[model samples]
Target: MPAPCHRTPSIKMVRGDITEQSVDAIVNAANSSLLGGGGVDGAIHRKGGSAVLAECRALRAAHYGRGLPTGQAVATTAGRLPARWVIHTVGPVHSRTEDRSTLLAACHTNSLRVADSLGAATVAFPAISTGIFHWPITDAAPIAIAAVLDTPTSVQEVRFVLFDDAAYEVFTQTWREWKQ
Candidate 1:
């Protein structure tokens, strides 16, 4: 798919597949295992091919043996994917009993940090934990947008690549509210 338009104070919300985004980097909403699971993680691993998994395995062998911690991010080769790098971040699962908003926000903030370290000007991010992890899009949207906006980074473009209309609407609405 075509890359999203670049605008100053850049943040764009797109409804489509994250793997198709032709950006400098794409953020993977990965589980702690970082080995690959369902949802966005699986799609990225599949499309990015063995080179991606190979780097992930090397990461595990070298440093993340216990797996990546929640709210943390690590970068790997994008393999056959369009982007140069895949920033894999582990988002906290939603919990009714405990507030994990900070952890959720960390996923976005940390991913941006990694993207900046890689000198990636354009980055695409999925709504972290909003799928199998059960993070309600309503609550997740604002945090994701806020974290990206609040963080200091060199990234010129940030695209929240939502999987569906509902998520796209929520993120776009949240972004609009923030802009206003």
Candidate 2:
């Protein structure tokens, strides 16, 4: 028999690229510019094609100046992925001078908020700042899990799609412990 889904607040850890995960929505770790950049951003843009950029440009024009606040998310069509919506979430960069806990929480909270707002039953997330943003993988693992655990939403399934072995291991280990 398949394992039952864990009931307590816990994140489902899976090994794969976030861009390819099939879910109602996928969270993109976007820069403040929202123009798309390296790492997960580039992969999503490349897979979703120019249409994603066009939609982002339109959003940028409409929501000018404010950009997107950390922990808050905005939605756009998936363009090419299996998912129908792309939730853009801005995660904090690990600059030594910046306090990123709140922003990290925001990343988790806002993504869930957007998904719940759209009535998505399932969502996929990438390790937000563990890439180019320099957030340590070990440190980020729990924060991501905590955010997902804290979100109050109709979302029934959440997948943490990790791009590499180290990240995958961290999420898996943390999730296993959290589940137990």
Candidate 3:
């Protein structure tokens, strides 16, 4: 094969809290409300402080009055978090009878698009929907990785900030396998 014409971003797997990531943007595994709730959303809201909530409130009052739809993404000031912007994407809940993986993948793709629009060179993402939404790590890992790998964006670096060993390992192994 010929040399690649474009750059594929450097992917990093850091087993840590996404809230503390010091990147240009951090992807929040947010709920539709965007007012903040359990898991990553709650942590980001608590750590990022009132300014984050203020922006979220403004977003709700403006375009998201009915709440953000699943798979779509929006950006807000990172507030006290180490990043400059926070890209919030609501992931779909896992359903056994119905395949909702496309929505999950869209969460990653749309978040990257929002990050690119902000000129964010680096972004950190949490394992969206794998927590409260109950998306299986086994199924979610490949979808997340493929979405990032397939999407075209200006971001130079993408880091998956996993909170636990299970999430981290799944991402790590999935990425390694995908590279082959």
Q: Tell me each candidate's TM-score.
A: 0.95, 0.91, 0.96
How close to the true structure is residue 30 of candidate 3, measured as C-alpha lDDT?
96
Steric clash pairs (candidate 3): none
Please write out the lDDT profile of model 1 over residues 65-166, one tens digit for every residue.
999999999999999999999999999999999999999999988898888788899999999999999999999999988888788777898999998999
**Candidate 3 segments exceeding 4 Å error:** 1-6
Q: What residue runs in model 1 are displaced by over 4 Å at the alpha carbon?
A: 1-8
What tens-digit string does per-residue lDDT give for candidate 3 at 1-180? Answer: 222224578999999989888899999999999999999999999999999999999999999999999999999999999999999999999999999999999999999888878888899999999999999998998999889888888789999999999899999999999888
Q: Give the TM-score of candidate 3.
A: 0.96
lDDT of 1 at 97: 100
lDDT of 2: 0.84
Error of 2 at 2 (Å): 31
Q: How many pairs collide in each candidate, listed in order?
A: 0, 1, 0
